[model samples]
Target chain A: MIDRLAVIGVGLIGGSLARALRAAGQVGEIIGCGRSQENLELALELGVIDRYAQDPAIAVRDADIVFLAVPMGAMRELLASIGPHLATNALVTDGGSVKNSIVADARVAFGCMPPWFVPGHPIAGTERSGVGASFPELFRQRRVILTPLPETDPKATARVRAMWQATGAEVSEMTVAHHDEVLAATSHLPHMLAFGLVDALTRMDCSDEIFRYAAGGFRDFTRIASSNPVMWRDICIANRDSLSAMLARFSTEMSDLAASIRDADGEHLLEVFARAKAARDGFVDGGKSLAEHN
Target chain B: MIDRLAVIGVGLIGGSLARALRAAGQVGEIIGCGRSQENLELALELGVIDRYAQDPAIAVRDADIVFLAVPMGAMRELLASIGPHLATNALVTDGGSVKNSIVADARVAFGCMPPWFVPGHPIAGTERSGVGASFPELFRQRRVILTPLPETDPKATARVRAMWQATGAEVSEMTVAHHDEVLAATSHLPHMLAFGLVDALTRMDCSDEIFRYAAGGFRDFTRIASSNPVMWRDICIANRDSLSAMLARFSTEMSDLAASIRDADGEHLLEVFARAKAARDGFVDGGKSLAEHN
Candidate 1:
């Protein structure tokens, strides 16, 4: 059980982690900190946190555990500010979408890769954001991926895993590069496609009619386009390499599809479509392992 | 009420139309014709059709309305065979995704554009297809766009519109070119993207881990990728010009996005993302007109 938990940036992930630990009766005191006083107060009223601290340094000063849940853009500054005040033994982790960049931020801030810092991410969310949208059950049955540096203390990693497991999340460990690469394919690329598609349509001369005649299929395809743009912008900049690589690969295949259509190659079109349907069906029905966890 | 309604294809759209008309007491008889005898038998058992016919010519022989729900690739053959058998006054409409090509098919089959033929497409469906996957309420509150040739009889178009309206669909009319262009951007483009995205990932070395780590967003984005491959293939080829054009425009934008990501131009990414979110929000919250029918 956590003696004192410091949650910096009381947003969806931060607030939910606190709520889950409180609901599971596994935490003593939760200190919420953010730039937004209103959001911190809402977290306190919602019982998502025990008290509020406007200063990140103050928030992490006496905590046994500290969670960084702000957007990717804020991670570097927060890490720097809290580094000087953190309890020597506090296990530090984060819910940042991009692990490699934030791990670099930790390395720079702490003047080295701290053994107490365990970088992690929970693959659970809705379109909504903010503390008001958080719930204690947000992480239940979800997957939390941790990418701990080799020099990290095993006990620190265990504590982070135990915290997530307490919230009913299945925790898995991977190398930082692998976590970034896998998520770039699974999550980041899809969001970029959705955002790019919508942005492209809006730029067209027929934009008005395009959205007007859009069917439910179009809506579902663009659902992720409605996601927070600033956060996604940060994500784009955070994981630039893998995302650009995936985009180039996808663009090549897209050009092939366009050529196939131009040539009216029914056989080629059918083969690609059939293959896609098979892979998507397999993934949806049960990706050898997807069905087990999700 | 119609004396007899002949529905060729007998899949999701065709079966649902028959069930809706029957439920509303607007259709006197529904004769389902398809390549699959088992599917037709299931439709009859489910009361989606009053009877079944193996040949399209025999099916449309005595019908007042002929609804062609076959894939775009099969439209030419069905039009040719049914041309000699259809009643001169039959108001023939279709559920094919492409309008311009189907009109071409009708012209080729009849040696001219028939006044009795009115092409229509209902913008409603689930990922599931086949007669068994159909339901009567599928078109309720959904939009159906009809495109009629200039030489087409107004009464024929009106009858087709009334037929769809009776099934709780909101019907609108536009020229064949407009219908093809609008649908290519809204429906066809999104389907192609989903199919292409999934197909590209499957070709990657990390395809196994890609599908395994996929989250709910990836699943939702690829939902349409699981649609009937043959039908999508037909749609892609049938609307080749417009679909290819849209793909080119979107691909250019995708390249720009990739360059911005590589350059780490946060401003470009932020602006594009914000604009897309705004437009998507407007459409989803009710595009100037997307709000009404859907």
Candidate 2:
């Protein structure tokens, strides 16, 4: 059974994991690694981790499991630095939003795609980021989709799934490519549209007063536009191909809607809105885990 | 002093106004009118009004203040029926979102612009509709923008403004045309985009799974899409010209962002996200009043 665990890049996701693991008594000790000494200190002070390490490489030593909780762009550098120190028997995984690029990089950094390495994308998070926002139950009732390549070690995959389940997340499996495409349609594309909507709204001359008078409708539409830019930037670039395809498709749909509106086709507008409302209601009723805890 | 007040529609907005007037001891007797007898009965039961009525003409009789709180599309029809009954000395105001069309219709219905008619839109509401959701404090700390036409009476406008102040709402004035244009960008466009985004995302093959896996981000983004579609449909049609113009502008900007993604331009993507982040932060810091009460 896995006992000791190390978490790299102790931000919102990692810090939450540490808190959840410790609260559930799922791990004997949790080690935190980050570039910011102050954040590491804060994590230790909050008892989110049992120890802190300035060097990423040494942080993984003697750990039975390690999570690379950093951004996708930083994953390769992080994996390269920690690769030599990783015990062959230790299972490695990630909480990245995108998977294909990370999976490819992990294969390169670990000599071959180690059986102990599993790629995961937890479909949960908040607009707020950082260690301060970390909560133990952040992932409670949330889905954690794992993209296990064909050569993945069965035992390693099982351990990873068990660990996620212990943290109160429902575990599901998909191929790396499928995960990317699905997330692009559901998550990434929505984010891009939100950001684009806000940008469009703000440029209007009277938007300041308009935003002031904005009801719950505007607030909800622009919510995702308030997310962390750097993280989203990386995700968009890392999964550029799929996201681009999704965006193209979305643009076509939007153009059609706009045309219908221009033509004063009330029937078409109502049809689209009704379809969306029904689909959204159906999804909510289906009861999927919205986020993973810890 | 406005001794008798008539509130048309008796839904959340009208009921809340009636309740506030009674709660503040501002009106001698409040008469609530609506096509829905059940809604009027419940409004009286909830103490939202002092009495109820079925006919627009009878409700406005001898009323020193008359508030038209029906849906935007119904405003013209209501005004036509009540125009003959509106006392020349009475202050006639509305709770409609779009002002230009309503104001124009009011002018035509009265054969000339009634000096006492004032057009106002309160920038406050909850997701729940109908009289049951009405509360005295719904307008507190919220904005109530008034758009008084050139022919509006000064005394009538002052009376309406004072009434809104009694509910603790700050009143601001603008032209009806400008108000419609501004709201199209801020309120209408956002709802349209949110509905479209939710609709687009939920139609995917894994929609049920995606909805199940949706986090706070997706929830927030689509929350507004759950609003009453008929109300939104009326709004879009009432302000179709401005909404269509705003949508065209928004589409142009969305296309630019889509083009950047297609080219895999990380720098451009980061720049766009960064700008949007800053804009949202600035908006929040500006103390703009889009705060959700629920």
Off by over 4 Å in 1: A287-294, B287-294
lDDT tens digits, residue span A1-294, model 2: 357899998888998888887778888988999889989898988999889898988999999999989888899888888888988788899999999999878878876787778999777787777788899987777788998888899888898898888778889998888888888877898899788877776776766776676665666667788888888988998898999888877777777777776776777778887777776665554543232222
Best by DockQ: 1
Tens digits of per-residue lDDT for model 2, B1-294? 459999998887888888887888888988989999998899888888888879999999989999998877788889999888877678789988888788778877877788888899998776568999889999987788999877988888898999998988878898888889888877787778777877777667776656655666776677667666666766777788888898889889888887887777878888888878777767665545334531
What number of clashing residue pairs does each candidate have, in the order they appear?
A: 0, 7
TM-score of chain A of each: 0.95, 0.95
Per-model interface RMSD values are 1.1, 1.8
CA lDDT of each candidate?
0.89, 0.82
- Lowest summed lDDT window (length 10), candidate 1 chain B: B285-294
Question: Can you give the lDDT of residue B153 in candidate 1?
Answer: 94
What is the clash tally of candidate 2?
A: 7
Which residue pairs show backbone clashes in model 1? none
* lDDT at residue A209 of model 1 (Cα atoms): 79
Q: What DockQ class does candidate 2 belong to? A: medium
User: What proportion of the real contacts between chains A and B does each prediction keep?
Assistant: 0.86, 0.60
